[model samples]
Target: MKFSRLLAVLALAAGLSGTGASGAGAAERVRVGILKFGTVAWEMDVVRANKLDAANGVAVETVDLASPDAARIAFQAGEVDTIVSDVLWAARLRAEGKPVVYVPFSAAEGSVMVASGAPIRSVGDLKAKKIGVAGGPLDKGWLLLQAYAKKTAGLDLAREAEPVYGAPPLLQQKLESGELDAALIYWNFAARLEAKGFRELVSVEGAARGLGAEGQVALIGYVFRQDFADAHPDLVKGFVAASRAAKALLAGQDAEWTRIRPIMRADDDATFAALKRRFVEGVPSRPIAEEARDAAGLYAQIAAIGGERLVGPAKTLPDGTYWQGK
Candidate 1:
């Protein structure tokens, strides 16, 4: 009889332990990685506006990643479940075996290279002059600039000029101080410097003319791990719902400017207005022909600049490279 009583106590203890574990697991949250860029704010608002996490029974978390390389590394290490960044990194990641699915569009380019004092007026004039790009050989900005040089002016960027790599803030400062001849700059930063007399040397729009700007897309996108997507299908759908709503909200004047001003580094309304006019708006559809072509053009530039040295075939990005979610 005593042994029977001990058995009942052991069973009760096991049941209590199981119940405690289940409660803890239920309260756990999921971690998401993100950048502080403009689109991220839109996403944050949308998620809240739609109450996605609450509806889906999952808590959304965000980590601020400094660079594309760092984001890629984190995603590969499984530290993050999703990210918002350039699709170029996605293609490269899939090619390297750390696979992730492209979810939806993020920010479009109001990004370009600006020259101080207007020494370089057009794309052709960049020959033999130093150009500032973000990454060295692997930078999409460098590839775009090089392709523009080659296709528009027939100048070979690989041998003809010097390409400098630095952070956007530092590069823009150098451009303003006249330390660098030209620097790849976004619309917001470039507008702030325009008050100081910096001018557009070339644009992402112009590059679309020769570099598949219309047919090939180059905008940023939101990406999620395929396994995560599969495991949490309902949660993924909620995220999509939130992003679509954010894109709609971004189409409005008051909504966009209200969000953009705080993110603008320059402390001026005129700069914010100029950037809003010249850079933001029109988040575009997933299958942007010009953007896709620009992406392909980048691949071609990579091919010319020893892409095969890194990955073989060195051809333009084929179909299925981007995922628009199922």
Candidate 2:
């Protein structure tokens, strides 16, 4: 009888221990997705350096994509919990009934136009010329570029010229071959083009400022499905914290480029240094009024180009929607 009682006690202890361990395990592991962009590199560095994800039991895995369209498709198929993409793209997804929400202010305005051989001087100079764009008409970068053109030179891009569609790498090659005049390239890739003898036609910083007519406004941020966010509130908050830490480190002029450079890309010091210096002055701490204004301005440009209304989020996000480390 004594032996039987001891065995029963052992069984009960084991059951309790097993239940506790299971609960703990469930609380610790969270799967997240990220892109292979420099923006994500900074955030990943924060996660690893601060040990934030591990401490919170979060396991973050980035899903690499070759194109924006691919990233959108993956997010829609439930392959990723979150993504680092433009606010407009997220807005478009939400409009398509996917219900993704922009993660407040989480972006660096890294979109810019580069002119090959200094032929294009300003955003307006591209009139009657062919411009290379990755996505077709109504592309996010194209829309923003249109807004800049309108604000800077009073030239409406919708009536100006044609946009040639091709991916950045292909477009860069086209520019190099003189097959294309100029291209709307992301800042990271645009910097590479500059290294290869391309010149900056315009920076999103100038465009953002010209369009908003106030503080800086640019499209950049983190986004996630609403259902995922509702299901993982703590996880969302932790992710936001990690993003803030990353941005803070990158925002510093004295940031350890030696550490960050390799993570961004295996580029030479000149390119990395130039890219880092460019972003140091103008990166936003949070998506605030300016982001909303910029979003509104971009939508207007898109509507003008398409001659139809766009199905997306609010014209301007509310002030509280974009805040740092929120």
- Which candidate gets the maximum lDDT versus the true structure? 2
TM-score of each: 0.76, 0.75
Worst 10 residues of 1 by lDDT: 1-10
**Per-residue alpha-carbon lDDT of model 1 for 1-326, expressed as tens digits?**
00000000000122111111112224324445656564464455454444444444434555666666776776777776666766656566666565666654644443445545466777777777777765456555566667777877898775787777777778787877777777776545666666666677666545644665544254567777667666766556555554555455555546655754665554666766665554334355544444555666656665566575534442556455555443
Off by over 4 Å in 2: 1-29, 55-59, 104-107, 110-119, 151-159, 253-256, 279-282, 287-290, 307-325
Which stretches in model 1 have alpha-carbon errors above 4 Å? 1-30, 37-39, 49-59, 110-112, 115-117, 253-256, 286-301, 304-319, 324-326
| Candidate 2 global lDDT | 0.58
lDDT of 2 by residue, 1-326 (tens): 00000000000112111111122233433333444564565656555555544555544444455555666675676665565676666666655566666754433453545555555776777888778886667566677678778766887776787778777789878878877777777666777776666787776655656665365554666676777666666666666655554556666535555666767774686678666765555456434554566666655565555443443554533233332223
